[model samples]
Target: MEKFTTLTGVAAPLPIVNVDTDMIIPKQFLKTIKRTGLGASLFYEQRFNEDGSENEDFILNKPAYRNAKILVAGDNFGCGSSREHAPWALQDFGITCVISTSFADIFYNNCFKNGILPIVVSPEELEKLMDDASRGSNATLTVDLEAEEIRGPDGGRIPFKIDAFRRHCLLNGLDDIGLTMQKSEAIQGYEGRMSENRPWV
Candidate 1:
């Protein structure tokens, strides 16, 4: 996990709704448990043709969006299956922030764990962001997690809200494993006391 205090980069517009986990990385690419290689397969079906050639129509494959670091998507983003690999694939593709009107609960949670920021905004706000993302080479948006706001290319700002604890975790780069490590001293002390008090066992 990496700290996510602020992010500013090109935002790719993905206006399709109900984008599920399978649509993101596809089932064929799930053979590997590792997270590194999934980026190449992100949105595999939409990004490639039957013969495995690149699809020129997909937003991600377009010249201006190939290196997009943020995504402005439609409603119900990440809707199906609770696959952690979806966020992994998105993060691997250099997209650390996702702005949508709404997101599936499981996928939203998974984003935070993987150091990706999943933002929920109003339908009106999403429309604005999507318009900004349509600017091709100039589709830049700055996400300031600490300020809970998004700054668009034209200098317009949209505010958002998130759980305070999740914000803290992302700011400090603390995943579940990192959170547990914070209690290592207390855990060690308890184990030592238990060993001495119950040696016969």
Candidate 2:
């Protein structure tokens, strides 16, 4: 996982609600456990047509949003299954932060582990973000994790809340493995003591 101290990039507006995990990466792409390369298949069904051509009507296919790093979506974002691949796909696609009214519990927790920031805001705040994102290429929002503020294109700022421990982990680029590694010395000592005391076993 990468450190997520701050990010400023294009914001794509996705107004449809109840966006499930399957809708994000689809089941066919789940066979591979590797996290990389999933970006190309993110939103596979809605992003492509029956003939394998890019769906022009899709928000992600639009030129302005093709490289969007922030997503301003509707309520209940990341709902349904608890697949970790959903966050992997979003992070691989360059989405560092997602602003929505609400998100499924599992998905929200997964985002932090994958280095993606899932922000929960009030309905009124989401409306403001959606309006800002409607600007297309100019829809840039700056997210400062340390300050917990989102600065919009016009200089307006919206504050957000996050768990302190999650914030600490993201700031230090610490995933589960990274967290474990922090106590490697202690773990090594414990193993050595166990071997010395129970060598017969």
Candidate 3:
């Protein structure tokens, strides 16, 4: 997990609603437990044609958004069965933050664990960002987590809310494993005590 203080990058506009986990990374790709290679399959269905050709009109397939680090999507983003791979694919594809009017609960929680920020904004605010993202080459938004602000290309800022604990996790880059490691010293001490008390076991 990497600390997410602030990010300024290309914002790809995906205005379609109900962008589910399977659409983000088709069900077939879920076989692999490893998280690294899923980037190529992020939005696999919409990105490729029947003959494995890149769909030219899709926002991610466009040249300007090929490296997009932020996504401005429609409502109900990441809706589907609880799959950790959803955020894995997004993070692997270099999307550090996702902005939408709403998100599925499980997917929203998974984002923080995988080092991706899932932001929930009002419908009106999301529409404004969606329009900003329509600019392609000019579509850049600054997400300041510390300040809870999203700055559009025109320098207008929109505020968002997040859970205090989740905010702390992302700010310090502390995933589940990272959080556990923070108590390593105490864990080691406990193990040492157990060894001394139960020599045979």
TM-score for every candidate vs. truth?
0.97, 0.98, 0.97
Weakest 10 consecutive residues of candidate 1 by summed lDDT: 24-33
> How close to the true structure is residue 143 of candidate 3, measured as C-alpha lDDT?
98
Worst 10 residues of 3 by lDDT: 130-139
Per-residue lDDT over 1-201 for candidate 1, one digit per residue giving the tens place of the 0 to 100 score: 789999999999999999999998888887888989899999999999999999999999999999999999989999998888899999999999999989999999999999999999999999999999999877689999999999998889999998999999999999999999999999999999999999886
- TM-score-wise, the better of 2 and 3 is 2
| lDDT (C-alpha, whole model) for all candidates | 0.93, 0.94, 0.93
Candidates in descending TM-score order: 2, 3, 1
lDDT of 2 at 65: 98
lDDT of 2 at 18: 96
- Compute the lDDT for candidate 2: 0.94
Reference-based lDDT, residue 144, model 2: 97
User: Clashing residue pairs, candidate 1?
Assistant: none
Tens digits of per-residue lDDT for model 2, 20-76: 999998999999999999999999999999999999999999999999999999999
